[model samples]
Each structure stands twice: as C-alpha cells, then as structure tokens.
Target: MIKIVEVESNKDLKSFIDFPHELYKSDPNYVPALYMSEKHLLTKHPFHHHSEMSLFLAYKNGKIAGRIAAILNVNYNTFHKDSVGFFGFFESTNDFNVAEKLFEVAEKWLKAKKAVKIIGPVNPSTNESCGYLVEGKNEPPVVMMPYNQPYYHDLFLKMGFHKNTDLLAYLIDVGSFQDKSVKMLDLLSQRLSKRGIIVRKVNLKYFKKEIAECMTVYNEAWDKNLGFVPMTDEEFEQMANDAKMILDPDFCLVAEYEGKAIGFTLCIPDINQIQIKMKKGRLFPFGIFKLLLGRKKIKKLRVLALGVKEEYRRVGIEAVLYGTLLKNAREKGIVEAEASWILEENQMMNRALENLNGHMYKRYRIVEKAIL
Candidate 1:
C-alpha cells in the first residue's frame, strides 16, 4: 500500500531533504545537495513571500518511495498573466504508481490554488534549479544544474506531461576554445571601448554597489526569457549572499558604458566537484576539511549567468565577457566549463557559444500539462 503524507514537521522535512541521498546512493554521478541549503530553500527562501508550496512524501510498505512540491508562484502568475502552477523537487522510485500518485497530489493541490495549467520540475522556480535530465547522463551535473536518472523523462511523459521548452548546457574546454575568438577578444574589446563600453572584472571593493548594478542588468537582461519572473530585491540579495562564498572575482565580469552597467557574466567554481566527496553533503566532522582542501583542486566552472541590456546587444560585449572569463580560467589552470541552461530559442547566444566551440552536452526539458 502507498500512503501520501504531507510534510508538516521538522522530522518529515528532514526526511524529505535526505531521501535523495539514500535514493541515489549507488549512483556515482549523483551529488548530494547541502542539507542546510535545501532546508532554507524549502522553508524560508524569499520566494515564499509571493508563493505557496506544499511538500509531500510517498511511502510504500513503511519506506519512503517518492517526494514532490506543488508550487503556486503568485509572482510568476502576476508577471506573465497566466495561472500556471509548478511541480518541483520531484523524486520517485521506478514504480509508475508512486510517480502517478505524487503528480496526482501535486495536481490536486495546484487545482485548489486556482492554477489553470501546470508546468515544471522547477524545484520551486526557474530562479533556482529547474528541469529534468532528458539527455547526457554520463557525468555528474555542473554547479547548480539538475541531474537524474534517464528514466525520469519517461516517468513524466507517462503521466501525460508534454514538452514546454528544452534547455541546453554547453561544455567548453578551456584549453581548446576557438583561437580566433580568443585572438579577436582584444580587438573587439578595444572597438567596444571606442563606443564608451569597457569590459572589466567585478570590483570587490564596492561589492554591494556592484551587486546592485548586477541586479539591474540581470532584471533587464532576463526579463524576456520564458517563465522568467523578476527577482525582488530581497530575493536577489538573498541569492547574492549565498553565492558570495564560492564566487571567484576573476570569473565575474561586467560590461560598462560610460560608467554605467550594461552587461555582466557570473561564473562560480564547480563546487559540485567538492560536494561529490563530502560524504552525504555534510560540512563538519571532516567534511569541512574535504571541502576547504579540495576548493583549489577544482578544475571547472559554470557560467551560471550572462546577460546584456537590450540596446547593448550585438556590440561584442557577450564575446568579451566569454573571452575574459575563458582567458582568466586558462591562466588559473581550470580546464573545463559549462555555460548552462540556455533556452533553445536563444539562437544568438547559442550561436555565440557554439562559435566558441561550446558543445551542447546535456539537454533538460521543462514539461507542462493543461490542468483545467
């Protein structure tokens, strides 16, 4: 018998967070998320200010079988003017019944919230981790990217979910990126300078000011993306605070025009490299040593974000950002990078990355179904 239980207590929440650690224990490429971080995201993240979500666990014969979170993103609905709910934090055993029950619970919850259509696997929202791994199951995911068994795609489809949009993850070898692109960087940057746009690393001395500028660029640059909802000041600040720990100033770049921020790219070390060895995602009792000792040994980074103002597009700022980051990465001995979660429809950015020899190694999809 399968029983569906809502997570209401700390004990249940802990089980909800820890289930995947046990579920994927035998899978070599599964990286366990930090328990503390998952806790905060579920219970206290700023998304809660404008959204309501419920977490549920499925148990069969007294053992946990699956988990899911049904989210009503009020902000997303208001911004897009669509009553779309989302399903995220999904995990289940191979049994079709368990998966169906989980989605049924999610659907029921969303319908009660007045959602007309359901779309996701967004782990809450696109602002955080989203998508299901439909391709590229060979290696572990890069930082802040989703990874799961190949069967997940089938599971969603079996439940009548259809493709919403496919997201692309491109891998760039730091040692072998297009030399022509590298060679033209200095020239292009110089040309951009003539237009009053200069490319430079983010200044840590004015960290807060730089972050504010980044927020501006981020909100403007990504506003047009599918399923994107502008981050409130609180949400951006909260995310920035968490990202500050692993941020490499060299990999963070900003494009300025006459002293005004126009574009930016933020990359962080692929911390999953360290987390993979952290033994169930703990940072104490020697996990701390493993983390600190392994930070410098990390060899890859994820271009977590890159964006330019609408008027600033096609002026070579994007190439400069990529070039500066790649050059700095090679100098620092990093050999692998992934520019991930790019929308498939973003042809210009996709072409730019492909021009730099970025290979589309992984593909993730957000699935949707009309609920009304």
Candidate 2:
C-alpha cells in the first residue's frame, strides 16, 4: 500500500530533502543540491517568515516513493490579489499511483487552507529555483535551475495539471557568438559615456552597498513579471549573502547614469559541474575541497539575473551588459553560458539573446490545477 506522511520531525525532514538524491541516483545528468543549503532553505529561510509550507513524503513498502511541499505564499496572494497555493519541492519514482497520492494529499491540505487554485513546482516561490524540466532532458541544468526526470511531466499531466507557462533557457556559445551588439561594444560604451551612463564591473570593495542598490533595481525591474512578488528586504539580503560566496566580481556588472545605478546583471560559475561529483550533496570531508578547488577550473556560467529600470529600457544598456559579460566569459576560457528561466513570452529579451546567437535549448513548465 502507498502511504503519505507529513514531514514533521527532523528525521522526516532530512528524508524529504534527501529523497531527490536517491531518486536520481542512476541518472547521469542529475546534480544533487548542497545538503546544508537545502537544510537551511527547508528549516530556517526568511521565506518561512512570510509564507507557510508543509512537506509530505510518499512511502511505498517502507521506502520513500515521492515527496512534495504544499505551500501557501501569503505574500504572493497579497501581491497578486488571488487565492492560489503552490506545490513544490516535488520528486517521485516512476509510479503514477505514488505521484497521484502525493499530490492528492498536498491538494487536500491547500484546499483546507481555502486555496482556490494550485500552481507550481516553484520550490516554494518564483524568486527561487522552480519549474519542471519538460524539454531538453539531454543535458544537466545550469546553476540554480531545476531538473527532473522525463516522467515527471507525465505525472503532472495524468494528475490533472496543465501548463500555466513555459520558462526558457538559452545556451550561448561564447567562442562563436557573433552579433552586432558585440561588435559595437566599444562604440556603445562611448555613446553611453557621453550620456553620463557607464557600464562597469561590480565593486567588491563595496559589496554590501552594491547589493543594496542592485536590490532596488531588481524589485523594480521584475515587478511586471508573471507571478512576481517583490522580495522582502530580509529575503533579498539572505539571497545576496548566499550568492556573495560564489560571486566573481567580474561577472557582476552595474550600469549607472551620473553615479546612480540604473541596471545590472549577475552571473555565477556553473558550480553544478563540481556539485555533480558530490555524494549526497554533502559539503564536508571532501565536497568543500571540490567546490573551492574546482571553482576556477569551471568554464561554464549562468546569467542568474539581469534587469534594468523600466525607464532605462531600449537605452542600449541591455546589449552593453550582455556584450561585456560575454567578453569577460571568453577571456576566462568559459565555453558556455546559459541565460535562463526567461519568460517564454518576453520577446524583447528573447530577441536580444537570439541576436547574440543564443539557442533555446531547454524549456521548463509551471503547471497548475484547480482545487476549489
């Protein structure tokens, strides 16, 4: 018989976090999440301060068969003025019965909370890693992106879920990328300079101040995105601290006009290349060395975030930032970079990446179902 159990104790929570590691063990492209980071996210992240989430695991014949988190994002509902709960941190075996039971329990919990609709695979929220890999299963995910077995898509469909939207991941070949924007990098910079706008690498000396400014741009820049909820200051700070550890200042750039920050882009090395080698995603005994020693050798990157103030759009700042980032990556011997989770309908950003010869190699879906 299949049983669904709420993750209430420390032991059960550990199982919930570790389930994916075991489920994807035989999959060559699987990259395990860092255990410590995952623990913090589940137990004490700032997200818990404003939202509610309950984790559940499916047990079949005394073994973990699946796991899911039912979330009621108060902030999301408050911001969007809608009644939608979320199901996230989902994983399962190839058993349709197990998947259905897991979601049944999660949906019941959200329904009791008075949620009218359920949407996700959001890993708790849109501001974090989300979406299920529905396409491009041939390769591993880049840093901070989600990946799942091909069967997860089937599970969602069979369980009455429908695609709400698609998020796109673009793979850019740095060595061969040729675009007018790249060729005009210098000319663009000179022109922007004449307008008192300058694009420059982030100043690590003033990291805190720099991040604070970037946070402002981020909140404003992404306000219009689908399902976007402005991150609280605490949430933004917590995220910034985590990124700071792996940040290469050269890959972080800010565009300023007359000393006021107007736009920025942040990229980080694809540490998944190193993390994939970690056993159980543990950072102790050996994983730390792999991370620290392997960072410089990583030649892949992910453009985690790039945004500009609404008023700054179409000012050539976006092109300048992309061109500069590519130039930096090429100089560092970076072979590939992925600018991802771009909303599929964002033609302006999509077109910009295409102009740079970026190929949309991966597509992720956010699926939803009615609960009320």
Most accurate candidate by lDDT: 2
Q: Which clashing pairs does model 2 show? A: none
TM-score of 1: 0.98
lDDT of each: 0.90, 0.91
Instruction: Estimate the TM-score for candidate 2.
Output: 0.98
Task: Give the TM-scores of the predictions, in the order they appear.
Answer: 0.98, 0.98
Which runs of model 1 end up more than 4 angstroms from their true locations?
none
Cα error, residue 7 of model 1, in Å, equals 0.5
lDDT of predicted model 1: 0.90
lDDT by residue for model 1 (1-372), tens: 999999999999999999998889999999999887899999999999988999999999999999999999999999988888999999988989999999899899999989988999998899999998888749889888997767888898898999999999999999876656577888998899899999998888898898899899999999988788989988998888888888888999999998989999989999999898877787878887887889899999999999999999987888888888988999999998999889999998899888888889889999999885
Going through the candidates in the order shown, the clash numbers are 0, 0
Listed per candidate, the RMSD to the true structure in angstroms reads 1.0, 1.0
